[model samples]
Target: MGMAMTSSPQPPPPPRRRRSRLQSATTISAPSANPKPNPKAKVIPLLSDVGRLQSATPTPTPNGNPSPNPKGKVLPLLSDVGSNPSAIDYYSRVASNLAGAGRLGDFLIAAEGLRAASGDAGFAARINWRLLSRGVVAALREHGLPHVLEFLRDADRIGVHATVMLDADASDAVAAACRQLLDERIMAEFVEAIEALARFFVKGIVDPMDVLKIFVRKRDPDMAIRYARIFPHSQLLLCNTMEAFGKRKELKHALKVFGALKDQLGGINMFACRSIIDICSHCGSSVQARIIFEGLLAEKITPNTHVFNSLMNANAHSMSYNFSVYKHMQEIWCPS
Candidate 1:
């Protein structure tokens, strides 16, 4: 009976684990055929690891407070940047590294993180905002104008100085906006674009005069006034925008601009009076020209010889009116 049991093939010896002289408590074993993931393994996320961040549920701390990160350093939620210096550097470096790696999408994530991190505290002042802006502008060049506009809004929300973006590429941004308008002819898009450019003007990146010209060329006096009003100190801009309409033979637009300016307490200077008179002369509205001259007197605006000449030209079709203008000139400007 004992020999039969021995011949029955002793149950396969329990799998042997060969020992090595080098083996120690710290020694790592080769992965099994189906090794389970290590729960304690450390995972260092890249700066651009947006998914991991967004999906990370706040872990409870020893004090029962939920923390965004484990090291007792609480990070702000996405889109809400806080003042953590290390967090700022983490995002900025990730952006730069991804940019250098030619990973545009990842770079974008890092850029957003950097911008968000800059919003709450003085972090914006500490980092190179210009460099961050440049990276975004470069990466989105292939994208559309809507994306550009969205970026501007994001920057604004993040407390980035408007000047920071303007300095990055003012002319290029303007040209891109204009090019989009030319392609689509969407007035809404054009308005949005002008709004963006107006930010540049407010920051002093673009000349206000150029902006005025752009609005006047669109022939929408209302839109022109709307934007011009954004700059409370744009009296000269209003007058010049009004005068430009005269050259376009848009008498009504000029009149509207003049009325809006007057309503805003924009002192009607001699330049504005002359511009309106010229417009009346072009449109052959001698009656309107006469009304403006009288109003100038009421406002105590000094009328010069140049005004009399323009008044006379305005009344070219009316001999009596022309004689009256001459008499006025003699009484005020050319008494000799």
Candidate 2:
């Protein structure tokens, strides 16, 4: 018993070791006396960033007035942005904004800025000429003749000639403008302008024949024929011009045009043959009509009733000639 009691009293249980609350929990780092901020964390605006900021800001009204806002503190306008933007950045942003807004009048004004901006390296080619041309053509269609002429004049100024021809609406506007020019007695200028534009007809975006028709209807058949010769496969226009010559009794010119079509378009369609025969009949050239009829036969082009009638009428002075054409038609129609 004495020995057990001695073992129990041994060391009073070595003073129950204790841990403080601070020892049990995580410790926070103390603040440095001179802390350094992270340099990489700071943001510097880029050219595009500056552009976006400006674009996101409000723009002044067209009349040089600020638009009213009932809400709290109005945002700064684009004009209010400081002069930190580069020329390319500034003009590109302005042109893009104006064009997107469909503000053609404003876009034209801004295009001057874009033209200036194009002087910078790699900027001229960066512009979307297709988009630019579309905007300009839509503007022309909306504003009509005055704006169409304005666009033509400014195309060179704005460096858009290479792109303007790619747009169908632009081509239509040009045709309309040419007609206007002709109506205004500006024939020499119209001719010069159209001749220059005709080089682009191979693009096939605009039909050269449509433009030629404008001149033809304006009584400028010589110019019409000149342009028609440029696109020889434009058979309808060539025939129309030949018919015009026939109506004017210019048989030599009509025959010359018909011959050009025959040479250029690789023989003639029924329409062309009919047109030439009608012209020959009108000019009372039975020999020329007979030659054309023989050529049509050589080409294996079946003669229609109109062709037979034209051939017979061309030689109406000779009953034998008329009877011969009639007999040929009967043989073709009734193979018996």
TM-scores for all predictions:
0.56, 0.45
- Model 2 has a clash total of 0
Tell me the deviation in Å of residue 125 in model 2: 10
Q: Which stretches of candidate 2 lie over 4 Å from their true place?
A: 1-189, 198-222, 229-234, 329-336
> Candidate 1's residue-wise lDDT over 212-291, tens digit each?
67767888888778767767566777888888998888889999998888888756666677888989999878889999
lDDT by residue (67-132, candidate 2, tens digit) is 764432422333332342454554555565555444555665555544553443334454455566
lDDT value, residue 161 of candidate 1: 49
lDDT for 247 in candidate 1 is 84
Please give the clash total of every predicted structure, in order: 0, 0
Candidate 1 residues lying further than 4 Å off, grouped into runs, are 1-31, 34-42, 45-88, 91-122, 125-143, 162-174, 201-219, 226-244, 261-265, 316-336
lDDT against the true structure, per candidate, is 0.66, 0.63
